[model samples]
Target: MSQPSSRPELTPRFCFNQTALRDFLRLSRSTIDDSITQNLNALLTPSTTAFNPTSTSTRSVTPPSSSRAIPAQTCTSFKHNVLFPSWASRSDVLDYCAGVATSPDPDDPDSVLRQIEDEKVRERVVDERLDPYSGRYFPREARTESLAMLMRNERMVEKVVRARTGSVVGERCGEGGGLEGEFDEWRRAQGSGRR
Candidate 1:
C-alpha cells in the first residue's frame, strides 16, 4: 500500500439550509405560536396544518412536479400569532400592526417600523420573514422589535454624533445602554466560555 500523505484531504462540509433557522433567530418570540411552543420540547411537537408531501426527491434530474405542503392554518389563541402563509389575509396583518404601534420618535430604533404608513414599507416588513412556511410578521413581531429600540437607537445616535461633531458621546460609564442584558444570551448562543 502507498504511504499515507502527511496532510489530511480537504473536503467540503454540508449543513442544513438556513431558511428555518433564519426564522428561528429573526422571528420575535411572540410570533411563535402558543400551540407550537406548548409542545416544542415533546417528541411529537405540534405543527401548523399542512397538506401534501413536505420532502422532495433530490435524486431526480429536474425539480419535482409537486410542491411541498403549505400550512393551511395556525394558532387561534392569539390574534398576533401568524405561522402560515394563508393566516394573514383581509389586511389583518397590517391592521394588527397599526393597532399596536406606539408613538414614533426620531431617536427610537423602531421608529422606522412604527412610522410605516406607506404600503411599500409595510409590504417589505411582512414579506421578509424568510420562512418558506410563513414569510410574514404579525403584530407581536412589531412589538418585540419596538422593545429593542432603546439599545439600537443609542448606537445610532452615537454614530451620527461622531460623524458630524468629530467627538464621541453617550458614554454611560461602562453601561451598554441595556445591551448588558443580552450579553449572557449572546455569549451562551456563541458557546464561548472560560477554559
Candidate 2:
C-alpha cells in the first residue's frame, strides 16, 4: 500500500510502546516480588489450622470453656513481663501492674521495647509480653491473643489468692488442700473425664 510517503521508517517497532513496556515491566516486577514475599512468609508462619474446620465462618464457632486458674509461674507476672525489673521506672511499673500499658516514649509505642538497655529485661519482654507462649495446653488453644489474656487473668487471680490467703478452683487450699495424690482417684469422681 503506497498512499502518502510522509511517515519515516527509522523508528524502532516493538509489540509494546516505550511507556507501555515500562508499565508492563514494573507490574511484572511487583507481582514477582509479592509472590516471593508471600512464599517466604509461608515458610515462617505456623501451618496449623483451627480445630473447627467445618464451620463456614469464625463467628459461628463455639468458644472453649474457661480454664482452671493456673499458678503464677505458669502465667504472666507484671514484674517480669511489663516493666524494667530493677524498679527503674517505678511510676510506669505501678501503672503497668494495674493493667495499664505505658510506652517508654509517649509518641511511639514500639519504643517501649526499644528503650530497654538490659538484655535480660528485653528478653523478659520478648518472652512474656511480645510472645507469651502457652505451656501444657497450648495445642488445644488456637488463638495466641486469647491465650495471653487467659494467662494474665490466671496470674491476677493467683496473685490475689497469695496476697489475701484466698482459695481458687485450681489452687483449692481452702478445701483442705488440693487433689489427693492417689492414682485413679480422679477417675473415681463422677465429673472427671477418666471416670
Candidate 3:
C-alpha cells in the first residue's frame, strides 16, 4: 500500500458570512430594530462572555472603585409582580372569557386570548429593551447603543486620543478637549501649506 503524505494540506482562505456569524453568536435577526442602534461592533461581540476565562488569557479587569449604589427607582417604569391589577392570570381570564365567548352567540374565546397573549409578548419585549443589562433581545436600530458598540466606540476614542496627545494622565476625554485641539491644529496646518 502507498504511504500517505507526511504533511497535512492547508485549506484555502474563506470569507466570513456576517449573517451566519451573528446567528452563531446567538444574535437573532429580530435584534436589529432601529437604524441608530445597530452598528457593526454589536454583531461581533460575544454575548455572555464579558471577560476572558481561559487560564493562559486570564487578566484582572477591575470594576469602578466608587461605592455609590444606583437607586432602584431610577428606572422609569415599575412592574410589580403581584400588585399589578392589569396583570391577568391566563387561567382566570381564559375561564371567564370561556363562558362569555362560547355562550349562545357572542364571540370567539381563542381569538381574544391569542390577541391578548400576543400583545403581552410585545409589551414584554419593549420592556426588555428598557433594561440594557437584562441581555434580553433589543433590535439594533431601536437604541443608540448595544453594550459592545459603546465599548468599541469608547476604545476607539481612547486610542485616537492617546495616539495624538501621548498623554494618559487625564480622565476620560471631555466634549471639547484634546480632540477639538487636534482637529484645529490639522486644519491650520492644511491651510498654511495650501499657500
Candidate 4:
C-alpha cells in the first residue's frame, strides 16, 4: 500500500465570467419571481387571523380600564418574555440576556456596563465566520463582485423589458431601427452636450 503525501494540495481559485453570470441570472428570473411571490404571501398572511376573537364572537366586549399603570418590573418581565426567545438560536445573545437579567446596575447613569456587555455580544457574534470578505469561510473573493454582476444583470433585464414594452427612449431610433440607432443617437447627444 502506497502512503499518501503529507503536503497540502493547492487548488486554483475559480473566477466567475460576467457574461455567463448575467445569462444565468436571466435564466433564473422565474425562480426569483416565485421567491418574491412566496415572501409577499408570507408577509401578507396574518398569523393570528384565524384565532381573531372579534370575528367569532357576537357579544359586545368592553375595553379593559387602564386607570392603574402597569408595574415597571412587570413591564420589563413581559418585554423580556416576548423578546428573549427570538434570540434563543444565538448563544451570544442568550449570554448577554443572562448577564443583563442577573446584574442590576443602577449606579451607572449612562448604562456603560450594559453598553460594554452589548459590545461584547456583538464581537462574539460577528467573528470570522460572519466576515463577508474572508476566503477561509469560502474560496471566493468579495461578495460585492457577485452583487455588482447581479445588479448589472438586473439593469440589462430592465432595459430589455422597457424595449419590449416600447417604453425605452429611441428604441427604434437607429438607421436599422434598433439598438445601433439608439447608440448613434446617444453618441450624438453626448457630442452636442460637450459644446
lDDT of candidate 3 over 94-152, digit per residue (tens): 23333333334223234556566656656764444677665444332211122234334
The TM-score obtained by model 3 is 0.18
Q: Write candidate 1's Cα lDDT for 1-195 as tens digits.
A: 011112212111100122332232224222322223232222122455664364454444653322221122211112122222212221132233233334332344454655563445456634345665554444424433443343244335433432321111012111123322332354354355433
TM-score of each: 0.15, 0.16, 0.18, 0.22
Which candidate leads in TM-score? 4
Most lDDT-accurate candidate: 4
TM-score of 1: 0.15
| Cα lDDT listed for each candidate | 0.29, 0.29, 0.29, 0.35
Decide which is better by TM-score, 1 or 2: 2
Score candidate 4 by TM-score against the native: 0.22
lDDT of 4 by residue, 95-153 (tens): 33234334443543345655665566556543566675533322233333444454555
For each predicted model, how many residue pairs clash, with residues at least 3 apart or on different chains?
Answer: 0, 0, 8, 1
List of clashing residue pairs for candidate 4: 174-181
Give the winner by TM-score: 2 or 3. Answer: 3
C-alpha-based local distance difference test score of model 3: 0.29
